[model samples]
Target: MAKTNLKTATAKQRIFRKAINLLNQIFFTWNNGNEEELVSFLQTIRDKSPNVQFQKLIASSVPFLNAFVQNQNSNLFSRIYRHPFIQGYSLPYEVGNTKLVHSDWLRSVLIRAVCYCSSVEDFNLERIYLELTCLTNGYSLRFVETHVQHFFNFFHLHPMRYSRDQIMYNKFRHNWFNYIKIQHELSDQLQQFDDKGQLIHLNYLYEYGAR
Candidate 1:
Protein backbone atom coordinates (compact mmCIF):
# COMPACT_ATOMS: atom_id res chain seq x y z
CA MET A 1 0.00 0.00 0.00
CA ALA A 2 0.92 3.69 -0.04
CA LYS A 3 2.56 5.40 2.94
CA THR A 4 2.91 9.11 3.65
CA ASN A 5 5.99 10.73 5.13
CA LEU A 6 6.56 14.17 6.53
CA LYS A 7 9.96 15.82 6.83
CA THR A 8 10.32 19.05 8.74
CA ALA A 9 13.15 21.53 8.65
CA THR A 10 12.82 24.83 10.49
CA ALA A 11 9.52 26.36 9.38
CA LYS A 12 9.12 24.28 6.22
CA GLN A 13 7.36 20.91 6.07
CA ARG A 14 7.61 18.60 3.07
CA ILE A 15 5.32 15.62 2.54
CA PHE A 16 6.03 12.72 0.20
CA ARG A 17 4.83 9.20 -0.50
CA LYS A 18 6.49 5.82 -0.14
CA ALA A 19 5.31 2.28 -0.75
CA ILE A 20 5.19 0.01 2.27
CA ASN A 21 3.06 -2.66 3.94
CA LEU A 22 1.35 -0.22 6.26
CA LEU A 23 -1.75 1.26 4.64
CA ASN A 24 -2.30 4.98 5.17
CA GLN A 25 0.63 5.12 7.57
CA ILE A 26 2.30 8.52 8.14
CA PHE A 27 5.89 8.86 9.24
CA PHE A 28 6.99 12.07 10.94
CA THR A 29 10.66 11.42 11.29
CA TRP A 30 13.92 12.14 9.59
CA ASN A 31 16.13 9.74 7.65
CA ASN A 32 17.65 8.62 10.94
CA GLY A 33 14.23 7.36 12.09
CA ASN A 34 13.97 9.77 15.01
CA GLU A 35 11.61 12.62 15.98
CA GLU A 36 8.44 10.63 15.31
CA GLU A 37 7.21 11.29 18.82
CA LEU A 38 8.01 14.99 18.62
CA VAL A 39 5.97 15.35 15.45
CA SER A 40 3.12 13.30 16.92
CA PHE A 41 3.09 15.53 19.97
CA LEU A 42 2.95 18.59 17.77
CA GLN A 43 0.11 17.08 15.79
CA THR A 44 -2.07 17.09 18.89
CA ILE A 45 -1.86 20.89 19.01
CA ARG A 46 -2.61 21.11 15.30
CA ASP A 47 -5.65 18.86 15.73
CA LYS A 48 -7.06 21.35 18.20
CA SER A 49 -6.94 24.12 15.61
CA PRO A 50 -9.99 24.28 13.32
CA ASN A 51 -8.39 26.36 10.53
CA VAL A 52 -5.52 23.99 9.82
CA GLN A 53 -5.86 21.07 7.43
CA PHE A 54 -3.52 18.16 6.72
CA GLN A 55 -2.85 16.89 3.20
CA LYS A 56 -1.19 13.73 1.97
CA LEU A 57 0.21 12.86 -1.42
CA ILE A 58 0.63 9.36 -2.89
CA ALA A 59 3.45 10.16 -5.32
CA SER A 60 7.22 9.99 -5.07
CA SER A 61 7.48 13.45 -6.51
CA VAL A 62 5.31 16.40 -5.55
CA PRO A 63 5.19 20.13 -6.27
CA PHE A 64 5.45 22.33 -3.18
CA LEU A 65 4.83 25.95 -4.05
CA ASN A 66 7.38 27.02 -6.68
CA ALA A 67 9.61 23.98 -6.31
CA PHE A 68 9.14 20.36 -7.36
CA VAL A 69 10.56 17.90 -4.85
CA GLN A 70 11.33 14.23 -5.55
CA ASN A 71 12.05 11.45 -3.09
CA GLN A 72 14.69 9.00 -4.35
CA ASN A 73 15.79 6.26 -1.93
CA SER A 74 14.61 8.49 0.92
CA ASN A 75 16.72 11.41 -0.27
CA LEU A 76 14.87 14.54 -1.35
CA PHE A 77 15.76 16.60 -4.44
CA SER A 78 14.19 19.76 -5.74
CA ARG A 79 13.78 21.74 -8.96
CA ILE A 80 11.86 24.75 -10.22
CA TYR A 81 8.16 24.17 -10.82
CA ARG A 82 5.92 26.23 -13.11
CA HIS A 83 2.31 25.48 -13.82
CA PRO A 84 1.42 24.64 -17.41
CA PHE A 85 -1.36 27.21 -17.57
CA ILE A 86 0.97 30.06 -16.56
CA GLN A 87 3.80 29.02 -18.87
CA GLY A 88 5.06 31.78 -21.19
CA TYR A 89 2.89 34.29 -19.41
CA SER A 90 4.51 37.42 -17.98
CA LEU A 91 4.23 41.18 -18.14
CA PRO A 92 4.70 41.79 -21.85
CA TYR A 93 7.86 43.72 -22.71
CA GLU A 94 5.91 45.98 -25.05
CA VAL A 95 3.75 47.13 -22.19
CA GLY A 96 4.36 50.33 -20.21
CA ASN A 97 6.18 48.57 -17.42
CA THR A 98 9.51 49.99 -16.37
CA LYS A 99 12.71 48.43 -17.70
CA LEU A 100 13.74 47.63 -14.15
CA VAL A 101 10.61 45.55 -13.68
CA HIS A 102 11.30 43.44 -16.76
CA SER A 103 14.95 42.96 -15.89
CA ASP A 104 14.23 42.14 -12.24
CA TRP A 105 11.62 39.60 -13.23
CA LEU A 106 14.00 37.79 -15.54
CA ARG A 107 16.81 37.86 -13.00
CA SER A 108 14.55 36.49 -10.27
CA VAL A 109 13.41 33.66 -12.53
CA LEU A 110 16.99 32.76 -13.44
CA ILE A 111 18.06 32.86 -9.79
CA ARG A 112 15.22 30.53 -8.83
CA ALA A 113 16.17 28.15 -11.66
CA VAL A 114 19.77 28.05 -10.49
CA CYS A 115 18.93 27.68 -6.80
CA TYR A 116 16.11 25.15 -7.23
CA CYS A 117 17.40 22.66 -9.79
CA SER A 118 19.42 19.90 -8.14
CA SER A 119 21.15 18.78 -11.36
CA VAL A 120 22.79 20.54 -14.27
CA GLU A 121 20.43 18.83 -16.70
CA ASP A 122 17.43 20.17 -14.80
CA PHE A 123 18.98 23.64 -14.71
CA ASN A 124 19.53 23.54 -18.47
CA LEU A 125 15.90 22.56 -19.01
CA GLU A 126 14.77 25.46 -16.79
CA ARG A 127 17.05 27.84 -18.69
CA ILE A 128 15.51 26.82 -21.97
CA TYR A 129 12.03 27.18 -20.51
CA LEU A 130 12.82 30.70 -19.28
CA GLU A 131 14.31 31.68 -22.62
CA LEU A 132 11.21 30.56 -24.47
CA THR A 133 8.93 32.20 -21.96
CA CYS A 134 10.73 35.53 -22.22
CA LEU A 135 10.83 35.41 -25.99
CA THR A 136 7.14 34.58 -26.20
CA ASN A 137 6.35 37.45 -23.86
CA GLY A 138 8.08 39.96 -26.24
CA TYR A 139 11.32 40.46 -24.29
CA SER A 140 14.09 41.55 -26.64
CA LEU A 141 16.52 38.89 -27.80
CA ARG A 142 19.54 40.91 -26.78
CA PHE A 143 17.99 41.75 -23.41
CA VAL A 144 17.42 38.10 -22.61
CA GLU A 145 20.84 37.04 -23.84
CA THR A 146 22.68 39.73 -21.88
CA HIS A 147 20.89 38.99 -18.58
CA VAL A 148 21.35 35.24 -19.00
CA GLN A 149 25.03 35.76 -19.68
CA HIS A 150 25.28 37.84 -16.51
CA PHE A 151 23.62 35.02 -14.59
CA PHE A 152 26.31 32.56 -15.66
CA ASN A 153 28.99 35.11 -14.94
CA PHE A 154 27.56 35.56 -11.46
CA PHE A 155 28.13 31.84 -10.86
CA HIS A 156 31.58 32.04 -12.51
CA LEU A 157 30.43 29.54 -15.13
CA HIS A 158 31.31 29.69 -18.82
CA PRO A 159 28.62 31.65 -20.63
CA MET A 160 27.84 28.86 -23.06
CA ARG A 161 24.40 27.37 -23.67
CA TYR A 162 25.35 24.43 -21.44
CA SER A 163 28.38 23.61 -19.35
CA ARG A 164 30.01 20.34 -20.35
CA ASP A 165 32.17 20.34 -17.20
CA GLN A 166 30.40 18.70 -14.29
CA ILE A 167 33.22 19.65 -11.95
CA MET A 168 32.51 23.35 -12.35
CA TYR A 169 28.80 22.81 -11.74
CA ASN A 170 29.54 20.77 -8.63
CA LYS A 171 31.26 23.75 -7.06
CA PHE A 172 27.85 25.37 -6.87
CA ARG A 173 25.90 22.16 -6.32
CA HIS A 174 27.41 19.70 -3.87
CA ASN A 175 29.65 22.20 -2.10
CA TRP A 176 27.61 24.25 0.31
CA PHE A 177 30.54 26.48 1.32
CA ASN A 178 31.30 27.57 -2.22
CA TYR A 179 27.64 27.94 -3.11
CA ILE A 180 26.95 30.15 -0.09
CA LYS A 181 30.11 32.19 -0.68
CA ILE A 182 29.07 33.04 -4.21
CA GLN A 183 25.54 33.84 -3.08
CA HIS A 184 26.79 36.18 -0.35
CA GLU A 185 29.11 37.97 -2.75
CA LEU A 186 26.33 38.38 -5.28
CA SER A 187 24.00 39.74 -2.65
CA ASP A 188 26.59 42.24 -1.49
CA GLN A 189 27.30 43.45 -5.02
CA LEU A 190 23.65 43.75 -5.97
CA GLN A 191 22.84 45.84 -2.92
CA GLN A 192 25.22 48.60 -3.94
CA PHE A 193 24.15 51.42 -6.24
CA ASP A 194 26.68 52.99 -8.69
CA ASP A 195 29.72 52.40 -6.46
CA LYS A 196 28.04 54.23 -3.59
CA GLY A 197 26.97 52.73 -0.28
CA GLN A 198 24.17 50.17 -0.13
CA LEU A 199 20.66 51.54 -0.37
CA ILE A 200 19.13 52.14 3.04
CA HIS A 201 15.52 52.88 2.27
CA LEU A 202 13.16 53.69 -0.54
CA ASN A 203 10.20 55.93 0.17
CA TYR A 204 7.22 56.80 -2.00
CA LEU A 205 5.71 60.17 -1.16
CA TYR A 206 2.38 61.29 -2.58
CA GLU A 207 1.53 64.87 -3.41
CA TYR A 208 -0.77 66.23 -0.79
CA GLY A 209 -4.18 67.50 -2.07
CA ALA A 210 -3.27 66.38 -5.62
CA ARG A 211 -5.38 63.25 -5.82
Candidate 2:
Protein backbone atom coordinates (compact mmCIF):
# COMPACT_ATOMS: atom_id res chain seq x y z
CA MET A 1 0.00 0.00 0.00
CA ALA A 2 2.82 2.41 0.85
CA LYS A 3 4.63 1.55 -2.40
CA THR A 4 1.47 2.21 -4.41
CA ASN A 5 1.07 5.60 -2.70
CA LEU A 6 4.70 6.49 -3.48
CA LYS A 7 4.23 5.54 -7.11
CA THR A 8 1.11 7.72 -7.34
CA ALA A 9 2.95 10.66 -5.84
CA THR A 10 5.81 10.19 -8.31
CA ALA A 11 3.41 10.13 -11.26
CA LYS A 12 1.74 13.35 -10.12
CA GLN A 13 5.15 15.02 -9.77
CA ARG A 14 6.05 14.00 -13.31
CA ILE A 15 2.91 15.63 -14.72
CA PHE A 16 3.47 18.80 -12.70
CA ARG A 17 7.08 18.91 -13.86
CA LYS A 18 6.05 18.59 -17.49
CA ALA A 19 3.51 21.38 -17.14
CA ILE A 20 6.08 23.71 -15.59
CA ASN A 21 8.74 22.81 -18.11
CA LEU A 22 6.34 23.30 -21.02
CA LEU A 23 5.19 26.68 -19.69
CA ASN A 24 8.79 27.79 -19.27
CA GLN A 25 9.70 26.72 -22.79
CA ILE A 26 6.68 28.51 -24.20
CA PHE A 27 7.26 31.74 -22.28
CA PHE A 28 11.06 31.92 -22.48
CA THR A 29 11.89 33.02 -26.00
CA TRP A 30 15.00 35.10 -25.33
CA ASN A 31 17.67 32.34 -25.50
CA ASN A 32 15.73 29.09 -25.35
CA GLY A 33 14.49 29.22 -28.94
CA ASN A 34 15.62 30.71 -32.21
CA GLU A 35 14.31 33.81 -34.04
CA GLU A 36 12.03 31.50 -35.99
CA GLU A 37 9.14 31.99 -33.52
CA LEU A 38 9.42 35.76 -33.98
CA VAL A 39 9.44 35.67 -37.77
CA SER A 40 6.76 32.99 -37.89
CA PHE A 41 4.16 35.47 -36.62
CA LEU A 42 4.91 37.83 -39.48
CA GLN A 43 4.87 34.88 -41.80
CA THR A 44 1.42 33.87 -40.52
CA ILE A 45 0.12 37.35 -41.21
CA ARG A 46 1.81 37.94 -44.51
CA ASP A 47 2.24 34.45 -45.94
CA LYS A 48 -1.11 33.66 -47.52
CA SER A 49 -2.73 32.50 -50.74
CA PRO A 50 -4.19 34.96 -53.23
CA ASN A 51 -7.80 34.06 -52.38
CA VAL A 52 -7.47 35.01 -48.72
CA GLN A 53 -9.22 38.24 -47.79
CA PHE A 54 -6.97 40.20 -45.45
CA GLN A 55 -9.82 41.71 -43.43
CA LYS A 56 -11.51 38.35 -42.98
CA LEU A 57 -8.32 36.76 -41.74
CA ILE A 58 -7.69 39.56 -39.28
CA ALA A 59 -11.30 39.50 -38.10
CA SER A 60 -11.30 35.76 -37.51
CA SER A 61 -8.14 35.87 -35.43
CA VAL A 62 -9.31 38.76 -33.23
CA PRO A 63 -11.31 36.64 -30.75
CA PHE A 64 -8.52 34.09 -30.36
CA LEU A 65 -5.99 36.89 -30.01
CA ASN A 66 -8.17 38.72 -27.51
CA ALA A 67 -8.62 35.53 -25.49
CA PHE A 68 -4.85 35.12 -25.42
CA VAL A 69 -4.37 38.67 -24.10
CA GLN A 70 -6.92 38.33 -21.30
CA ASN A 71 -5.31 35.11 -20.15
CA GLN A 72 -1.95 36.88 -19.81
CA ASN A 73 -3.53 39.84 -18.01
CA SER A 74 -5.16 37.48 -15.55
CA ASN A 75 -1.82 35.81 -14.92
CA LEU A 76 -0.13 39.16 -14.36
CA PHE A 77 -2.97 40.37 -12.16
CA SER A 78 -2.74 37.26 -10.03
CA ARG A 79 0.98 37.94 -9.40
CA ILE A 80 0.49 41.40 -7.92
CA TYR A 81 0.13 42.41 -4.27
CA ARG A 82 -3.54 43.30 -4.00
CA HIS A 83 -3.35 43.91 -0.26
CA PRO A 84 -4.04 47.50 0.91
CA PHE A 85 -0.82 47.47 2.93
CA ILE A 86 1.45 47.03 -0.07
CA GLN A 87 2.46 50.03 -2.23
CA GLY A 88 4.84 48.46 -4.67
CA TYR A 89 5.57 49.14 -8.36
CA SER A 90 4.06 45.89 -9.58
CA LEU A 91 0.59 46.84 -8.38
CA PRO A 92 -2.08 47.07 -11.09
CA TYR A 93 -3.62 49.99 -9.19
CA GLU A 94 -0.51 52.00 -9.96
CA VAL A 95 -1.47 52.23 -13.62
CA GLY A 96 -4.57 54.26 -12.80
CA ASN A 97 -3.53 56.21 -9.66
CA THR A 98 -0.50 57.36 -11.64
CA LYS A 99 -2.95 58.35 -14.37
CA LEU A 100 -5.49 59.88 -11.91
CA VAL A 101 -8.44 57.70 -10.81
CA HIS A 102 -10.55 56.60 -7.82
CA SER A 103 -9.39 53.01 -8.15
CA ASP A 104 -7.40 51.16 -10.76
CA TRP A 105 -9.23 51.99 -13.98
CA LEU A 106 -6.97 49.73 -16.04
CA ARG A 107 -7.40 46.97 -13.53
CA SER A 108 -11.14 47.47 -13.51
CA VAL A 109 -11.33 47.19 -17.26
CA LEU A 110 -9.13 44.14 -17.21
CA ILE A 111 -11.26 42.54 -14.52
CA ARG A 112 -14.50 43.35 -16.28
CA ALA A 113 -13.26 42.06 -19.62
CA VAL A 114 -11.25 39.12 -18.47
CA CYS A 115 -12.11 37.95 -14.95
CA TYR A 116 -14.29 35.11 -16.23
CA CYS A 117 -11.94 34.08 -19.01
CA SER A 118 -10.84 30.46 -18.77
CA SER A 119 -8.14 30.45 -21.46
CA VAL A 120 -5.39 32.72 -22.77
CA GLU A 121 -6.46 35.90 -24.52
CA ASP A 122 -4.94 38.67 -26.59
CA PHE A 123 -1.35 39.98 -26.31
CA ASN A 124 -1.72 43.79 -26.32
CA LEU A 125 -4.65 45.28 -24.43
CA GLU A 126 -2.78 48.61 -24.33
CA ARG A 127 -2.86 48.86 -28.10
CA ILE A 128 -6.55 47.91 -28.13
CA TYR A 129 -7.29 50.51 -25.47
CA LEU A 130 -5.57 53.08 -27.66
CA GLU A 131 -8.41 52.79 -30.12
CA LEU A 132 -11.09 52.88 -27.41
CA THR A 133 -9.82 55.90 -25.53
CA CYS A 134 -8.96 59.50 -26.41
CA LEU A 135 -7.30 60.30 -23.07
CA THR A 136 -4.31 59.41 -20.82
CA ASN A 137 -1.10 57.35 -21.13
CA GLY A 138 0.83 60.13 -22.98
CA TYR A 139 -1.52 59.80 -25.90
CA SER A 140 -3.51 62.34 -27.83
CA LEU A 141 -6.53 61.43 -29.96
CA ARG A 142 -4.42 61.66 -33.10
CA PHE A 143 -1.50 59.74 -31.62
CA VAL A 144 -3.73 56.88 -30.44
CA GLU A 145 -5.40 56.62 -33.81
CA THR A 146 -2.07 56.32 -35.60
CA HIS A 147 -1.04 53.29 -33.55
CA VAL A 148 -4.11 51.31 -34.58
CA GLN A 149 -4.77 52.94 -37.92
CA HIS A 150 -1.64 51.52 -39.51
CA PHE A 151 -3.02 47.98 -39.37
CA PHE A 152 -6.06 49.07 -41.29
CA ASN A 153 -4.01 51.20 -43.65
CA PHE A 154 -1.71 48.26 -44.28
CA PHE A 155 -4.50 46.31 -45.86
CA HIS A 156 -6.51 49.27 -47.14
CA LEU A 157 -3.62 50.59 -49.20
CA HIS A 158 -2.11 47.32 -50.30
CA PRO A 159 -4.46 44.46 -50.93
CA MET A 160 -1.72 41.93 -51.56
CA ARG A 161 0.86 42.69 -48.84
CA TYR A 162 1.92 45.09 -46.10
CA SER A 163 3.65 48.21 -47.35
CA ARG A 164 6.60 49.87 -45.60
CA ASP A 165 4.72 53.16 -45.28
CA GLN A 166 1.66 51.48 -43.82
CA ILE A 167 3.47 49.75 -40.97
CA MET A 168 6.38 51.98 -40.06
CA TYR A 169 8.89 50.82 -37.46
CA ASN A 170 7.74 53.19 -34.72
CA LYS A 171 4.05 53.03 -35.68
CA PHE A 172 3.32 49.42 -34.76
CA ARG A 173 5.80 48.64 -32.00
CA HIS A 174 3.11 46.88 -29.95
CA ASN A 175 2.76 44.30 -32.70
CA TRP A 176 6.23 42.88 -32.11
CA PHE A 177 5.46 41.55 -28.63
CA ASN A 178 1.92 40.76 -29.64
CA TYR A 179 3.11 38.48 -32.43
CA ILE A 180 5.66 36.82 -30.18
CA LYS A 181 2.93 35.91 -27.70
CA ILE A 182 0.66 34.94 -30.56
CA GLN A 183 3.35 32.58 -31.79
CA HIS A 184 3.39 30.92 -28.38
CA GLU A 185 -0.39 30.59 -28.30
CA LEU A 186 -0.36 29.23 -31.86
CA SER A 187 1.87 26.38 -30.73
CA ASP A 188 -0.76 25.22 -28.23
CA GLN A 189 -3.58 25.59 -30.73
CA LEU A 190 -2.42 22.84 -33.08
CA GLN A 191 -0.76 19.46 -33.29
CA GLN A 192 0.77 20.25 -36.65
CA PHE A 193 3.36 22.90 -37.57
CA ASP A 194 4.52 25.40 -34.93
CA ASP A 195 4.81 29.16 -35.28
CA LYS A 196 8.41 28.68 -36.45
CA GLY A 197 7.21 26.33 -39.22
CA GLN A 198 8.64 23.34 -37.33
CA LEU A 199 6.57 20.21 -37.00
CA ILE A 200 5.77 19.86 -33.29
CA HIS A 201 5.03 16.10 -33.27
CA LEU A 202 8.12 15.40 -35.33
CA ASN A 203 10.24 17.84 -33.33
CA TYR A 204 9.28 16.92 -29.77
CA LEU A 205 12.82 17.75 -28.80
CA TYR A 206 12.78 17.65 -25.00
CA GLU A 207 16.54 17.96 -25.39
CA TYR A 208 17.04 21.69 -26.18
CA GLY A 209 15.61 23.45 -23.11
CA ALA A 210 16.11 22.87 -19.39
CA ARG A 211 14.05 19.90 -18.24
Candidate 3:
Protein backbone atom coordinates (compact mmCIF):
# COMPACT_ATOMS: atom_id res chain seq x y z
CA MET A 1 0.00 0.00 0.00
CA ALA A 2 2.86 2.40 0.90
CA LYS A 3 4.70 1.71 -2.36
CA THR A 4 1.48 2.20 -4.37
CA ASN A 5 0.83 5.57 -2.66
CA LEU A 6 4.44 6.68 -3.29
CA LYS A 7 4.15 5.83 -6.98
CA THR A 8 0.88 7.81 -7.27
CA ALA A 9 2.49 10.83 -5.58
CA THR A 10 5.56 10.63 -7.86
CA ALA A 11 3.34 10.46 -10.96
CA LYS A 12 1.37 13.53 -9.81
CA GLN A 13 4.60 15.45 -9.17
CA ARG A 14 5.89 14.56 -12.63
CA ILE A 15 2.65 15.78 -14.26
CA PHE A 16 2.79 19.03 -12.27
CA ARG A 17 6.43 19.62 -13.26
CA LYS A 18 5.62 19.02 -16.94
CA ALA A 19 2.66 21.44 -16.76
CA ILE A 20 4.90 24.15 -15.29
CA ASN A 21 7.58 23.60 -17.94
CA LEU A 22 4.93 23.78 -20.70
CA LEU A 23 3.62 27.10 -19.33
CA ASN A 24 7.19 28.51 -19.18
CA GLN A 25 7.82 27.48 -22.79
CA ILE A 26 4.53 29.04 -23.88
CA PHE A 27 5.36 32.34 -22.20
CA PHE A 28 8.87 32.31 -23.70
CA THR A 29 7.44 31.69 -27.17
CA TRP A 30 4.88 34.47 -26.73
CA ASN A 31 7.53 36.98 -25.65
CA ASN A 32 10.24 35.95 -28.15
CA GLY A 33 7.99 35.27 -31.22
CA ASN A 34 10.31 32.50 -32.53
CA GLU A 35 8.10 30.66 -34.99
CA GLU A 36 10.52 27.78 -35.58
CA GLU A 37 11.00 27.23 -31.87
CA LEU A 38 7.26 27.34 -31.29
CA VAL A 39 6.66 24.83 -34.09
CA SER A 40 9.29 22.42 -32.71
CA PHE A 41 7.95 22.82 -29.13
CA LEU A 42 4.39 22.20 -30.28
CA GLN A 43 5.44 19.10 -32.25
CA THR A 44 7.21 17.73 -29.15
CA ILE A 45 4.13 18.44 -27.00
CA ARG A 46 1.86 16.66 -29.51
CA ASP A 47 4.12 13.63 -29.66
CA LYS A 48 4.38 13.42 -25.84
CA SER A 49 0.77 14.25 -25.08
CA PRO A 50 -1.68 13.39 -27.85
CA ASN A 51 -4.65 14.63 -25.82
CA VAL A 52 -3.31 18.22 -25.78
CA GLN A 53 -4.07 20.23 -28.89
CA PHE A 54 -3.12 23.74 -30.02
CA GLN A 55 -4.74 25.95 -32.67
CA LYS A 56 -2.18 27.30 -35.12
CA LEU A 57 -2.30 30.81 -36.54
CA ILE A 58 -4.49 31.22 -39.62
CA ALA A 59 -3.63 33.89 -42.20
CA SER A 60 -1.21 35.49 -39.73
CA SER A 61 -4.03 35.99 -37.26
CA VAL A 62 -4.87 34.05 -34.10
CA PRO A 63 -7.34 34.41 -31.28
CA PHE A 64 -5.81 34.76 -27.81
CA LEU A 65 -8.14 35.06 -24.88
CA ASN A 66 -10.66 37.87 -25.68
CA ALA A 67 -8.65 39.42 -28.52
CA PHE A 68 -7.55 38.50 -32.03
CA VAL A 69 -3.92 39.30 -32.77
CA GLN A 70 -2.88 39.84 -36.40
CA ASN A 71 0.54 40.27 -37.92
CA GLN A 72 0.24 42.67 -40.88
CA ASN A 73 3.21 44.01 -42.83
CA SER A 74 5.56 43.48 -39.86
CA ASN A 75 3.17 45.40 -37.61
CA LEU A 76 1.03 43.68 -34.98
CA PHE A 77 -2.63 44.63 -34.47
CA SER A 78 -5.38 43.35 -32.20
CA ARG A 79 -9.13 43.64 -31.72
CA ILE A 80 -11.89 42.23 -29.61
CA TYR A 81 -12.55 38.56 -30.40
CA ARG A 82 -15.86 36.81 -29.88
CA HIS A 83 -16.25 33.08 -30.28
CA PRO A 84 -18.42 32.13 -33.27
CA PHE A 85 -20.39 29.73 -31.11
CA ILE A 86 -21.47 32.56 -28.77
CA GLN A 87 -21.84 35.33 -31.35
CA GLY A 88 -25.62 35.26 -31.09
CA TYR A 89 -25.71 35.48 -27.29
CA SER A 90 -26.70 38.80 -25.70
CA LEU A 91 -25.00 40.45 -22.71
CA PRO A 92 -26.52 40.24 -19.23
CA TYR A 93 -30.13 41.42 -19.32
CA GLU A 94 -30.29 45.08 -18.20
CA VAL A 95 -33.81 44.72 -16.80
CA GLY A 96 -32.77 41.88 -14.49
CA ASN A 97 -29.89 43.77 -12.87
CA THR A 98 -29.65 46.99 -10.86
CA LYS A 99 -29.02 50.20 -12.81
CA LEU A 100 -25.63 50.60 -11.15
CA VAL A 101 -24.59 47.09 -12.10
CA HIS A 102 -25.70 47.60 -15.71
CA SER A 103 -23.87 50.91 -15.99
CA ASP A 104 -20.68 49.47 -14.48
CA TRP A 105 -20.78 46.42 -16.72
CA LEU A 106 -21.33 48.50 -19.87
CA ARG A 107 -18.53 50.92 -18.99
CA SER A 108 -16.07 48.09 -18.20
CA VAL A 109 -16.80 46.28 -21.48
CA LEU A 110 -16.50 49.49 -23.51
CA ILE A 111 -13.14 50.20 -21.89
CA ARG A 112 -11.94 46.71 -22.77
CA ALA A 113 -13.06 47.12 -26.39
CA VAL A 114 -11.23 50.41 -26.66
CA CYS A 115 -8.03 49.04 -25.13
CA TYR A 116 -8.02 45.86 -27.24
CA CYS A 117 -8.89 47.34 -30.63
CA SER A 118 -5.80 48.72 -32.42
CA SER A 119 -7.64 50.36 -35.34
CA VAL A 120 -10.59 52.75 -35.54
CA GLU A 121 -12.52 50.36 -37.79
CA ASP A 122 -12.15 47.52 -35.30
CA PHE A 123 -13.16 49.76 -32.41
CA ASN A 124 -16.23 51.01 -34.28
CA LEU A 125 -17.18 47.46 -35.21
CA GLU A 126 -16.93 46.39 -31.56
CA ARG A 127 -18.89 49.47 -30.49
CA ILE A 128 -21.73 48.58 -32.84
CA TYR A 129 -21.72 44.99 -31.60
CA LEU A 130 -21.83 46.17 -27.97
CA GLU A 131 -24.73 48.51 -28.75
CA LEU A 132 -26.71 45.75 -30.42
CA THR A 133 -25.99 43.33 -27.59
CA CYS A 134 -27.08 45.85 -24.95
CA LEU A 135 -30.22 46.77 -26.86
CA THR A 136 -31.19 43.14 -27.31
CA ASN A 137 -30.63 42.58 -23.59
CA GLY A 138 -33.32 45.22 -22.74
CA TYR A 139 -31.07 48.27 -22.28
CA SER A 140 -32.70 51.55 -23.24
CA LEU A 141 -31.37 53.40 -26.27
CA ARG A 142 -30.98 56.59 -24.24
CA PHE A 143 -29.02 54.79 -21.53
CA VAL A 144 -26.73 53.18 -24.05
CA GLU A 145 -26.17 56.44 -25.89
CA THR A 146 -25.46 58.28 -22.65
CA HIS A 147 -22.83 55.78 -21.48
CA VAL A 148 -21.22 55.58 -24.91
CA GLN A 149 -20.95 59.35 -25.08
CA HIS A 150 -19.54 59.40 -21.56
CA PHE A 151 -16.88 56.91 -22.59
CA PHE A 152 -15.81 59.11 -25.51
CA ASN A 153 -15.84 62.17 -23.27
CA PHE A 154 -13.68 60.42 -20.66
CA PHE A 155 -11.09 59.80 -23.37
CA HIS A 156 -11.53 63.43 -24.63
CA LEU A 157 -12.72 62.24 -28.04
CA HIS A 158 -15.57 63.47 -30.24
CA PRO A 159 -18.80 61.75 -29.16
CA MET A 160 -20.17 61.25 -32.68
CA ARG A 161 -19.57 57.76 -34.09
CA TYR A 162 -18.80 58.95 -37.61
CA SER A 163 -16.46 61.68 -36.32
CA ARG A 164 -13.97 59.18 -34.87
CA ASP A 165 -10.60 60.07 -36.38
CA GLN A 166 -7.76 57.55 -36.68
CA ILE A 167 -5.11 60.17 -35.84
CA MET A 168 -6.94 61.11 -32.66
CA TYR A 169 -7.42 57.46 -31.74
CA ASN A 170 -3.73 56.80 -32.24
CA LYS A 171 -2.88 59.78 -30.06
CA PHE A 172 -5.14 58.42 -27.35
CA ARG A 173 -3.46 55.02 -27.59
CA HIS A 174 -0.02 56.62 -27.24
CA ASN A 175 -1.13 58.63 -24.21
CA TRP A 176 -2.69 55.55 -22.58
CA PHE A 177 0.78 54.36 -21.53
CA ASN A 178 1.37 57.68 -19.73
CA TYR A 179 -2.03 57.35 -18.07
CA ILE A 180 -1.05 53.87 -16.79
CA LYS A 181 2.20 55.27 -15.41
CA ILE A 182 0.28 58.00 -13.55
CA GLN A 183 -2.03 55.34 -12.09
CA HIS A 184 0.98 53.35 -10.85
CA GLU A 185 2.42 56.48 -9.22
CA LEU A 186 -0.91 57.16 -7.52
CA SER A 187 -0.97 53.54 -6.26
CA ASP A 188 2.52 53.96 -4.81
CA GLN A 189 1.45 57.19 -3.11
CA LEU A 190 -1.56 55.42 -1.60
CA GLN A 191 0.70 52.65 -0.35
CA GLN A 192 2.99 55.24 1.31
CA PHE A 193 -0.04 56.78 2.96
CA ASP A 194 -1.10 53.38 4.26
CA ASP A 195 2.37 52.72 5.63
CA LYS A 196 2.36 56.08 7.40
CA GLY A 197 -1.10 55.36 8.91
CA GLN A 198 -2.49 58.38 7.07
CA LEU A 199 -5.06 56.36 5.13
CA ILE A 200 -7.93 54.42 6.62
CA HIS A 201 -9.26 51.24 5.02
CA LEU A 202 -13.01 50.91 5.43
CA ASN A 203 -15.38 48.09 4.63
CA TYR A 204 -19.09 48.77 4.86
CA LEU A 205 -22.22 47.14 3.54
CA TYR A 206 -25.36 49.06 2.68
CA GLU A 207 -28.65 47.66 3.98
CA TYR A 208 -31.36 48.17 1.36
CA GLY A 209 -34.10 47.62 3.91
CA ALA A 210 -32.75 50.42 6.09
CA ARG A 211 -32.63 52.74 3.12
Q: Each prediction's Cα lDDT score?
A: 0.60, 0.33, 0.64
Candidate 2 residues 1-211, lDDT tens each? 2223323433423221101233222111121234574344324434442222222222111222222221242232111112346442232344423433412343344333322222222213332543344344343565434433444454243221123332342233344336546766876876455565765354332221110
Q: What local lDDT does model 3 show for residue 126? A: 82
> Judged by TM-score, which candidate is best?
3
- Stretches of candidate 1 above 4 Å error? 1-29, 34-41, 44-59, 87-89, 92-96, 159-161, 173-211
Spell out the clash pairs found in candidate 3. none
Residue-by-residue lDDT tens digits, candidate 3, 74-169: 577788888887756466544643666667777778777767788988888888888887788766888788888877776676543555688877
Q: lDDT at 67 for candidate 1?
A: 77
lDDT of 1 by residue, 1-211 (tens): 1121122232353433322233443333233334574456347546554444456454678776667877788777778887777735565444543566667777777767766777778888888878877777666788778888876776466543477455666565555446656777887777665358655666773331100
**How far off is residue 201 in model 1, in Å?**
3.8
- Residue-level lDDT for 30 in candidate 3: 37
Worst window of 10 by summed lDDT in candidate 3: 12-21
